[model samples]
Every structure is written in C-alpha cells, then in structure tokens.
Target chain A: MGEESKKELTLSVSAPSGTSKEDHASRRTFIKNLAIAGAVIGTNALVAKKVASVVLEKDPQRAYLEDVLPGDRVMMAREYVVMTDEEKKRLVKTLIENYKKRLG
Target chain B: MKREDKKTTIEKNIEGSTRRDFLKKTGSLSVAGLAGVATLMTGTKDAQARVTWAEWFQTNYRLMTEEEKREAIERLEKRYSEEYGKKVTVDGRPAQKNVLFGYALNIQKCIGCRRCVKACVKENNQSRHDPEIEWIRVIRMEKGKFSAEDMDKGYPSDYGIQVGGNAYKNAGVVLEGQHYYQPERVPEKDAFYFPIQCMQCEKPPCVKVCPVRTTYREPDGIVVIDYNWCIGCRMCMGACPYWARRFNWGEPNLPKEEMNPDTHYLGNRPRMKGVVEKCTFCLQRTRKGRYTACVEVCPVGARKFGNLLDPESEVRRILERKRVFRLRVDLNTFPKFFYFID
Candidate 1:
C-alpha cells in the first residue's frame, strides 16, 4: 500500500474513543489492522518502535501514574512508568498479608 | 508517608517470605520481564556490560550477597569508566561501624554566598542542561518575617520591590526556579540564608516510598540511591517534603574538562535521563574520612559535619553546646541536618 493509504488505514482503524459493544468490535478490528501495519513497517525496527511508542503511551495501564499523580510535573513522566500510591500500597499490603499468613 | 514508629512496615513486611517468594511478593517477577525487555531494547549492552537481564534483576543492596555486591560495584565502575573515558571508582563503602553522620549549619555565620550549592553541582555530577539540576537550594529569607510565599518574589523585605514589573533601578533579584542566584553579594543586611538539601532523615520518607527499594539508609545513617536500579519513577520525589530529589529530564551534560572523576556507586556517578538523584553527604569523600563538598567549600566555615556518635566530634559538640533546631520538627523525620547559631 502507498504511504498515504497506510496513514489513512491507521486513523480509520484506531482504538475506539469510548466503551460500547460497537467500540469493542472496532477495537478488535483496529488491533488486526495494527498487526498488518507493524508487519509492513517492521522492516525498519526504529520507525516501527517510534510509531509503537506513540500507541503504547495511549494505553490505559500506562496512564495510571500520569492521571492521579499530584505534582507540578504532570504528564512529564508519561514516557516513564511509575507505580502509583494506590498500586504500591495495594501490592505491598497484599504481599505482606500473604507473607504473614504463610508464616503463621 | 510511613511513620517511623510503624512496626512491620513495607520495608520489613516480607520477612516471612523466602527470597524467591519475596521476589514474587514485591511483584518484581511480573515487572522483571518488562524491565528486561526495556533494558534490551533501549540500552542493550550499554557501556560494555551495563544493560543485561542479570543486572536488571539484581536484588537490592541490603539483600544482596557479598559476591553480588562486589559484582554490582564492578559493573558500575566499568560502565562509568567507559562513559567518562577515565578510571572511575564506584565504591560500595558501608557506613563506619560506630559512626552516625550528622550536620549542623551555623545560620549566623552563613553569608548566603551559595558557595556550597555550586560545589555540590560539580561534586554530585548534576545535570547542567535545559532543566538544570542541583540538589541544594539556598533560601534567602528576612530575619524575622519568614513566610515561604516571599521566596517567589526574591525581593528585599522592606523595599517591596516588585521584580520584572516595577521600574526600580535594581528590581529585586532574578531567581531561577526559586533558587537565589548571582545577587553580587549575599546576606543582604536584613536577610538570613537557609541552604537545604537531603536531611538524611533517620526515617526518610523517600526511602519508604520507593517501590523498587532503590533508595535506602546506610548503617552509618546516610540516605543514598542506586542509580542503576532506580526505575526513573518519581515517587520518592513526591514523598520528599523537602523536595530534595532531582530527576534528569534529559541526558546529563557534563563537560569532560569539568567532570569530577571521584565517584561512588550510590553518589556521584554520571546519571542518564529519568533516574532520581539527591545528596548523599558526598559518600565518595565521607567514606575516606574527608568532609563533604559543601563543608569543604563554605567560605565562612558555617557548615559542620562529623560522626554524631563521637562525643568529641564537632557535630556532637555543636549539638551539646550550640542552640540548634531542625526543619519540620512536627513531622518527626528526626533529620540529621541541624540549623545552629554560634
């Protein structure tokens, strides 16, 4: 496919903007198209990674820190993933509880 | 923030688990894969032997075996030597057995010269880039009228000189990032200087908040960070009430001619973009029985540092003989740093 067509394909098939059955269906379609696009562009790993990073950054799992972290430097650390207060607390608490239970 | 009195806090919560299970408990196992992939993709074999699964998965310093500690130091030394094009020592210097570090600054003797701040940047290998990094911030405040709000104005307390907008011949001072800089003279008659850095708290909030356990207190009671192990998460920065931690927004720019070769694994090693850094009382020098860069450079000899445990040490004498106070006493951080008057 031509460069312009590939760009159009990416835009048209992007992950849905909202939660709905239709959006889920479109999201699946987008993932499939994304696979094809990666295969086409993966010949140049650097270019593919650059494009992939832009997509990866939009992932909800990644946005957890940037969303709730209260600081002047909001969105500055979007590129780096940091565990949130809630996540760290939950993880450590659960781990410790399990450890205590196992020991007892 | 985890209170100092809290028993069985996160730091010791994994005591019941085995090493392998503890690894899983910390969720390092799940994240290890991500860390491994990250190291491989972004920094594969950087500086000879830096980027590897083995290095990425290495346990925390406190948990590491003697052999592991040796290897860790070796890796850091090798990596830094290659990066700086010279022999760099990354010491794994443990705190002295009987020594507990403490600092006392004589606010009366302080001239607000900011000489300590300059020395600190060079000693700590701080980033001298667009988002300039320095671990020390000297706050010049009015003697009696001390409101943190006045810090932003950077003006003479009595003058009411509005910086930038007012048409005064000398429109106050132009502070960069709330850090007082280049006022021609320090200790403006009615002003007193407070230079702040890591307090090396007996119960450091930063250490408690670190999810990866990359920062910790040494036996001799100095707080330090492992740059290699730090995941570039700024959680510690947020936890620090003093704002002691600094993050490199981009690759640090250290000129070859200007770079101080003396370094420690937990202290002054050259840092990449993202990792958090803070003062370690200049562990590279402190371990060798030398004073910190701040203490050595203070023009007025206002800074005092020594083994807090030694009855004869200057710091101990200051604690006994001088009128001293700590920052944020209500927080009960029990900061090693003290402000004193002669």
Candidate 2:
C-alpha cells in the first residue's frame, strides 16, 4: 500500500464513527490557537492590570518623598504638632506656603 | 470618792461615743475605697486589653469600620508623638487617594552588609524586642541551584570574604568567574541576599484570606493592613508566601528616644498590640517623594525602588536590562518583587 493510502486508512480507523475531515482539522486549529491566545493574553493581562492600577492611583514621586527623608532631615523639617489654635494655623499656613512654592 | 467615780463614768461614756463615731467613718471610707480599687482594676483589664491567640484567629484583621481605623491611627500617632517628641501625621487617606510606593533590589550588587535591615528597623518604629515588624528580610540563596538547602553548605565558610580572593576589596565586584563565593556574612553572595518583603501581589493571598477585609491591595500595588480594623487574626501571615507579615505579640516596644515622627496614615506610625503588619513600601516616605529607608541606607547601590510604569524609572530599567526573576513564579502570585543574578 502507498504511504498516503495507509495514513488515510489509519485516520479512518481512529476517527469516530461519523466525524468529518473538516471538523477534525477545525478542532485541531482551534485548540492550537486557543492555547497561543491564552498564553499571550494571560501574562499580558496580569502585568497590565497591576501596572495600570498602580499608575492610575499612586503618585510615585510623592511616595518617594515620604520615604526618603533621613532621620535628621525629618527632625529638621519638624512636623509641628497642631495643639493650640495658633499652632494649627501656623502649620496650615506653612503647608500651604510650601505647596504653593513647589507648584510655582 | 463618789464625785470622782461620777467623773470617771462620764469620761468612759465620752470615750465609747468617740469610738463609735470613728468606726462609722472608717466603715464608709472602706466601702468607697474598695469600689474605687475595683473600678481601677477593671480599667487595666478592659475588653481592649484582653488579647488572645484564639480570639485573634477568630477576629478579622481587615474588616475595621472607618471610625475604628481612625481611632487606631489616632492612637498610633499619639503614641509616636509622645515617645519621639516629634509630630507624626497618621494620614488615613485611602491608598489610592494621595500616595504610592514601589520597591526593587539587585541581587548581583548586594554584599550582605545588613545596613538596610538595621535602617528599616530604626526608621519604621519596629519593636526592639522582636525586630521583625518592618517589611525587609535578607534571604541568602545559592546560584545555579535555587533552594535554601544547596546554599547552607557554603554559608558558614564564606563570612567577611568577598567573592574573589581579598584582591577585589573596595571595588564593585561583578560576578565574572565561577570561583566567586559569598563569605560568612549576615547577607552573603554566591548565595544572593534576597531581601524579601511584601510582594504586594496583584492577587494578594493576604487580602483574600483576611476575613474582615482589613488588609487590601491599594490602587498602587501597595498592600496595607488597617491596624485598628485588624482584630489580630494572623490569616495574612499564613497566606503570605514570602513570610513578610508580622503580628504584634505585645504593645510595640517603642523607646521614647528612637521614634520617627513623620508618619503617614497608611505607613509607619507606631503600631499597637494584636495587629498584623508588613512593609507598606515606606508609604510615608514614598508618598512625599522620597526613597524607602532600606533603599536609602544601602551602602552598596543594591536596592532600587521606583514606579514600574515609568519606563525611565530605575526599577523598570533594571527589569528591562537584567534577566530578573520574581520569587515563586510557579505560584502565579505576580509579585512586584524581582531579582537578577549576574
């Protein structure tokens, strides 16, 4: 028997009683593509979701600023306790002034 | 003789009346004093003071109401300020509201000099007693072989010696040859010092396991636990693959002299007993546009922390340039933590 005819005989024997050639080919292609798509989309989605959430919500520079202050530097920058009304106003004014300066 | 006897009788009667009066006053005072003492004892052993491990297991650490969280923050801030003599602002702003933090470490460059570890302890108000509250731990591991067991054999002998013979002292040692091995060190190379902390995983198991939703991933990939909301259930600790989370067994042993007063609502303020804590990526510092304490204190430029979204950020550049790998990639935790071996 020729090789092609022998392959055809094997397929016919293995095939379900009524399965079509087109159906088998399409199923094979679908499974292959589905796997490829799953891998590509799965990883991309995971990384993108995390990055997007962080970028959308967090101010990276601000977070850095809050963390970088040395012990001595923080002491020098002395966060004033808002105890008395006068102290509260002073602190508020200082913060506003600093913000304005930075914006400028 | 009769007159004298009358006088003596009168004196005896007066003494008996005085004794009765004294007894009545003493009886009233004793009752009042006992009541006061009882109240004082109850105050010490109030509902807030009775913390048990079983109670902790049942209590949800994450499901605190806003009011409860605020009260906790207030208490933390007060404690810090009192101890440190500096004003600490416990910002209760939502993680997405104002601040963001990210972290990175280069395994190739870290020399295992535990400066970052000490710095984190000091900066984060970590308990002197436990020293495990802050979000950093240096894990030594072997190259080619990834498991801890492979590195244990080489660990003891590698102390204080650089990877190359004493020749490369003071110069930046790049892993050029196979002979380079980490010496006996707290953090050693050959064995890479993987400083593992909150991976802030995209799908944080800590957040999922939290019964009260006290611990949640912020909009910026930072996972935070509301200490007030946390009923000290150590579910977060159990769920953490990196072993980054810690539970306060007692009131945080903060000495008045060593507290950092510049606090953030979601970041390092003095923590209370019975709350689980991990690294917030130094949110207080990061929120204000600064580097994390560990990153800043690293004598070698091993630690890099920045926005992964920013292509220009140091973290992004390292990720792009190096063959970086996250811990436990098999688990699909999607940890923000990364490491590179040269």
Candidate 3:
C-alpha cells in the first residue's frame, strides 16, 4: 500500500471515536482489502528477491572439511539401520584391529 | 532527808565509775562495731536473695550485652558440668570458627521409617517430655500427592468402641480409610517421605521476622536463634512454611543425665521458657567438622551433605548432576536444603 493510505488506515482503525456504524464499516473494509492485496504481491516479491539472492550466494557446505579442527573426528560411514551377523563380526574385527594398531 | 541524800550520793559515785568505763571502751567500739553491723547485714541480704542476672532482669537472649552473655554462658556451663558429671560447655564458640556443615536427602528412598525422627531427638538434646520440640519430623505422603492438606485428612482416627462392658479389637464400627502407624509397612503404594526441618535458608525468614534480630543466618548458612534474645513473639514460628520452629512453653524438661554436653553457640544449648528454637543442622556436632547425627544414621545412604561453595563438595556435585528441587520455589526464600526424588 502507499505510505499515506497505510498511515490513514492505521489511524482510522485505532481512533477511539471510530465506533460509529459508518466509521467501523469503512475501517473494516479498508483493512480487508489491504490484507488481500498485500498478501498476493508481498509473497511473490519476497520469493523473487530471495531466489535472486540464493543464485548470487556462495555454497557453505563445500568448505565443511576445511572448517573442521585438527583434533576433530568426522563420521565418514553411513549409519547402518539393519546389519547382518557377518557385517557385525566384520565391524568388530576392524575396531579391534584399529585399537591394537593404535596401542602398539 | 539525810538518808536519801546519802543513797543518791552513792548512786552518783557508781554512775561516775560506769561512765568512766564506757568512755574508755568507746574509742575501741565506735568504728569497729558500726563496720561489723553493716558487713553482717549486707552478707545476710546477699545470701538470702541469690537471683541470677537473667532472672533479675527477665532478659531473653536479645537483651544481653556481650559481657552479660559471656557471664551467663559461663554460669550455665559451670552449673551444667556440675550436674551432668562432665566438663559441659553449654555454649561453644560461634560455628564460623573452623566449623562447617551441609545436609541432603533422597526423598524417593525414605520409607517413612520415622527412625530418623527418634534419632534426631536423642542427638539434638530435645526434651523427652515433648519429643516434638526438636530437630526433625518425617512427613509420610503418597507420590504426586505430597501436599499438607492431604496428609492432614489422611491421619488415622480412633473411635473407642465398647462391647460387653469392655472394648474388644474390631468390635465397634470400623472407620473406613483409617490407617495406624506401623514401623515396617510403608504408608502408601507410591509412598514418598519428606523429612522436614530447618532449611538453613540462605535468606532465612525466621531471621528476618525476629523483631529483636535475635535470630540470624551465620556465614556458613546455618540459622541460629538466641534463646535469651527471643521475646517469645512466635513470629519466626509463623514465618516458617515447613513448621520447623517450636516455642519453649516451659523450661525444657530434659533429664540432667541425657542432655548433650558438646553444645555449639548456635546449637542445642538449653533454652529457657518463652523463646523459639529449631534445628541448627546439628551445628553443635556438625559445625565442629563432624557429620549430622541424622546423616550418619541413615541406613539407606539417602542423606548427603557437603559444602555447596566448594566445587568438589558432594552437595555441589549433586546440584550439578541431579534434578534437585526445594520445597516452595515460588517463595524465593533460597533454601540451602534440597530434595532429590532419585
């Protein structure tokens, strides 16, 4: 909405003396029209602005490895939902071997 | 006339000799005799009226000056030691001097045993005549229903029912929902026991409410009442939400033999009539760098106590690790005492 009209509408709605039938009806109608027009144009304009900004922005995820600290460890493997007996045994064997190598 | 004159002359001569004798004794008798009479009178009054300073002034603790308090304490200690057959110091030095204490309890673990209640009475030098006078009272409650209103209603009733000129067991009308005290059996299915005592609140209401400022919070968070200073207003008793305070309606009826002698300044020194008193968290024992009687006697290891200020203290550790709760968080009293369900 135009700034002048928006100010006028706000004043009309909040004015203490605006309890008369005519004043109340007019204020209600103005508010309803303002809400509808603002919703349609506001959503599209905001979305278009956001899309343009996103296209211009750099990807943050690409530098994930570089962001990690020296002592920090990362989970490299996928989290297993269901594992077979053989897979479990193999995982245990790998862990044991890693522990022994680290210790030695 | 001549005979009478002769008799008069003889009497005069005898009186003259007596006067001479009295004159001779007057120098020796005047000062010495007066001094002797005055000394005798003063001694008799002193012996006859042997009223203590406290009795003479009708002074409660708050009125006593430092010198007066010291003299009173000395007299009490001497009297108690003589009566109790030990060197019983009725008032030890203030607990701030190399003495600290802390207390904790697991509300979930307490089984409404009431053993702690009895133990505290013995340990704290409470009057046996009225066991209710001292340190602790274990309140039995059901879980999720620990309000005071419920417990008051649930207290058992005795309806004296007689049969055949004598009352028999279960003979009369049995009241439904009445429960008797049983040492072994738990009070409720989901029973929770909260042993209420002086919180030793960081901002103690009792200390604040005292008109004479007779009660005060020590540096180590123990609230102490000067029994001599308290004017028996019972304002502290009213201010305490936990009902931990008690008034000495009469001189404490303790047997001389059973009284605990190792009294701290803030702890169980025998209180005179017309004053308020409560748990000092066993300041007599604990403030001397010892554990509270209740804490040491807990069978389930439910109670824990330590310095909250020290990072390594058990109380600090519990506050850090456990979900501990005080009785009424809304009051903003800042109670040092805490209860943990687990």
lDDT (Cα atoms) of all candidates against the true structure: 0.69, 0.60, 0.60
- Per-residue lDDT for B1-342 in model 1, tens only? 124224324324433343346446447645865776665545544674443445667777777888999998887777767767888887777776666788989978988888898899988888665455777777655454444554555443457645542222221232323243457666677666667788998778999999999999876778998877789889998888666777765567887667777887778978876788889999999989999999999988999999876668998677666767666655657678877876
Residue-wise C-alpha lDDT for candidate 3, range B259-305, written one tens digit per residue: 88888555787666667778887877665667788888888878888
Off by over 4 Å in 1: A1-104, B1-54, B145-178
| Residue-level lDDT tens digits of model 2 in B126-150 | 8776323445655444443345443
- Give the CAPRI class of candidate 2: incorrect
The candidate that wins on lDDT is 1
Winner by DockQ between candidate 3 and candidate 1: 1
Could you tell me the interface RMSD of model 1? 22.1
Candidate 2 TM-score, C-alpha based: 0.52
Clashes of 1: 0
Provide C-alpha RMSD values for all models, in order: 21.3, 32.6, 37.8
The candidates' DockQ values read: 0.02, 0.00, 0.00
TM-score of every candidate: 0.63, 0.52, 0.55
